[model samples]
Target: MTETTHNTVTDERADLLETLAKHRQFLRFTTQDLTDEQAGQRTTASELCLGGLIKHVTSTERNWANFIEKGTSVMPDFASMTEEDFARRADDFRMLPGDTLEAVLAEYAEVARRTDELVAALPDFNASHPLPKAPWFEPGARWSARRVLLHIIAETAQHAGHADIIRESLDGQKSMG
Candidate 1:
C-alpha cells in the first residue's frame, strides 16, 4: 500500500511536469527551423503566423507574470506590436531583418522557465486575485488566480496546435514527436 501511494504521488507530479514541458516544446516548434521570412508568412488570410503567435505568447507571459502575479498595472501594447517584434522574440514575434530562430527559441525557453517558477510558488491555487473581479468579468463572477493559469495554459495549447499546423504547412516540419 505504501509503495502504491508513493507511485501515485510521483505519477501526478510527473504528469504536471509533462504538461508544462509540452507547452515549452510547442513554443520551440513555433520558433525553430524557420527563416525570417518563413516565420512571418501566414497561411490563412488573417494575421496569424508562427512568429505572431510567439509574440502573442510572450506578451501573455509578461502580463501573467508581471501584472497578475507581481501586481503591476502596466501591460504590453498589443495594437502596435509588429511582426518584427514577434520575430525577434523567441516566444514573441518581431519582424526585424536579423531576427533568427536561435534568439526566438532562447526567449521562449526563458519565458517558460519564468512562468513555471511563478506558478509553482503560488501559495494557494484558490487564492482570489483582483483582476477577474474587475469590470471585464461578468457581474457575479469572480475568477481565482488558479483559473487564470489554467486558462492561459489552455489558450497556449490551443495556439500551439495552430502553430504546428501552420509550421507544417510552411516547411513540412513535424512539431510533435
Candidate 2:
C-alpha cells in the first residue's frame, strides 16, 4: 500500500477510537458524585439504572470483541438453565445486592483497554467473521471487523444518551451542557 493510504487508515482508526472514548467519558461523567445506592436507583420509570447501564455496555462490548477475535461461538446452554439462572439472566440489566459503581467502572476500564489493544493489533479492518448461531440474528448474516467496531461505537453512544437521561432524573444534573 502507498504511504498515503496507510496514513489515512491509521487516522481513521484513531478517530474511531477517539469517538468511542468521548462517549465513554460522557457515560462516566453521568455517574460522577453518585453513591452506590444512587447509582443503582431507578430514578425513572424505566428499568435501567446507571450501574446497570455500565455493566450492560461493558459486557456487550467485551462479548462482541471476543467474537471478533474468535471466529466461532459456543452458544450458551439455555436449556439446562434453572429457574434461578433464568431469573438472574433477566436481571442482568439491574444492579443487585453487592453490585457497586466502583467495581463496574473498573471492569469497564479493563474492557476498554482490551478492546483498544485488539483494535490496534488487527491487520485488516475488512476481515469477515461468520454470524454466531443466535436466535436473535439472521441465519446467514456475516459482519466485517469494521462493522463490529462501528456497532460497538453505536451501542456505546446510544447507552451514553440513556445514562445522561437517567443522571438528569437523579438530581437535575446533565452530562453535557
Candidate 3:
C-alpha cells in the first residue's frame, strides 16, 4: 500500500485524482436530468455544450495519460488535415447526431478508469518525457508524470467551471447548488 504523508508523491497523486473525481462528478452533475436534445443545446453564444465539454475533457485526458505512459502523444496530422477533417474534429465538443449523453458519459468513465490504473502503476512521479511537437506547445518542453497529472486536474477543473455556467444557463440549474 502507498504511504499517505501530506507532501509525499503518493499523497499528491491521491489528491490530484480526488480533485479530478470531484470535478468529473461536477461535470456529470451538470448534465443530470437533461435529455439528449437538451444536452446538445447551446445555452450560451459560445459553441460549447454540456455534453460536448464532457466529451472534450474525456478525449483530452486520455491523450495526456497516453503521453505520460509513452514518451509522445498521438495527434492528428494537421498538415494533411483537410477542411472536412477539421470540421469533423470540431464534433469532439459538439453533440452531433448519434451522440447521446449516456454513450458519451460511458466513454468518459472508461477513459477515467484507464487513467487511474495507469497513474497507480507509475514507477516514478519524477519520470519525464519530451512533449510532442505542436505549435500550441512550447519548444522542447518536457513534463514529469506528476506535472502531467496536475495538468489533467487543472484541465478538468477549468472545464467543470465552463460546464457549471452552461448548466446554470440551462433551466437555471447550477451544478454547485
| Top of the candidates by TM-score | 3
Q: Please give the RMSD to the true structure for each candidate, in Å.
A: 6.1, 3.1, 3.2
User: Model 2: runs farther than 4 Å from truth?
Assistant: 2-9, 74-86
**What TM-score does structure 2 among the candidates reach?**
0.87
Please provide the root mean square deviation of candidate 1 (C-alpha atoms, Å).
Answer: 6.1
Q: Relative to the unseen true structure, what is the C-alpha lDDT of residue 7 in candidate 3, on a scale of 0 to 100?
A: 38
Residues forming the 10-long window of minimal summed lDDT in candidate 1: 1-10
User: After superposition, which runs of candidate 1 have C-alpha atoms over 4 Å from their true positions?
Assistant: 1-17, 75-98, 132-136
lDDT by residue (1-177, candidate 2, tens digit) is 421243344776788889989989998889999999998999899999999999989988888898788865632444466788777765657888999999999999999999987877677777878777656667778887778899999999999999999999999999889
Query: How many collisions per candidate?
Result: 17, 0, 0
Per TM-score, what order, best first? 3, 2, 1
lDDT of each: 0.63, 0.84, 0.85
- Model 3, 1-177: lDDT tens digits are 543333344766778788889988988899999899999999999999999999999988988888888777464544567889988878889998999999999999999999987787777777898877666778889999889988989999899999999988888898865
Q: Look at candidate 2 and tell me the lDDT of residue 28.
A: 88
Best of the candidates, lDDT: 3
Error of 2 at 44 (Å): 1.2
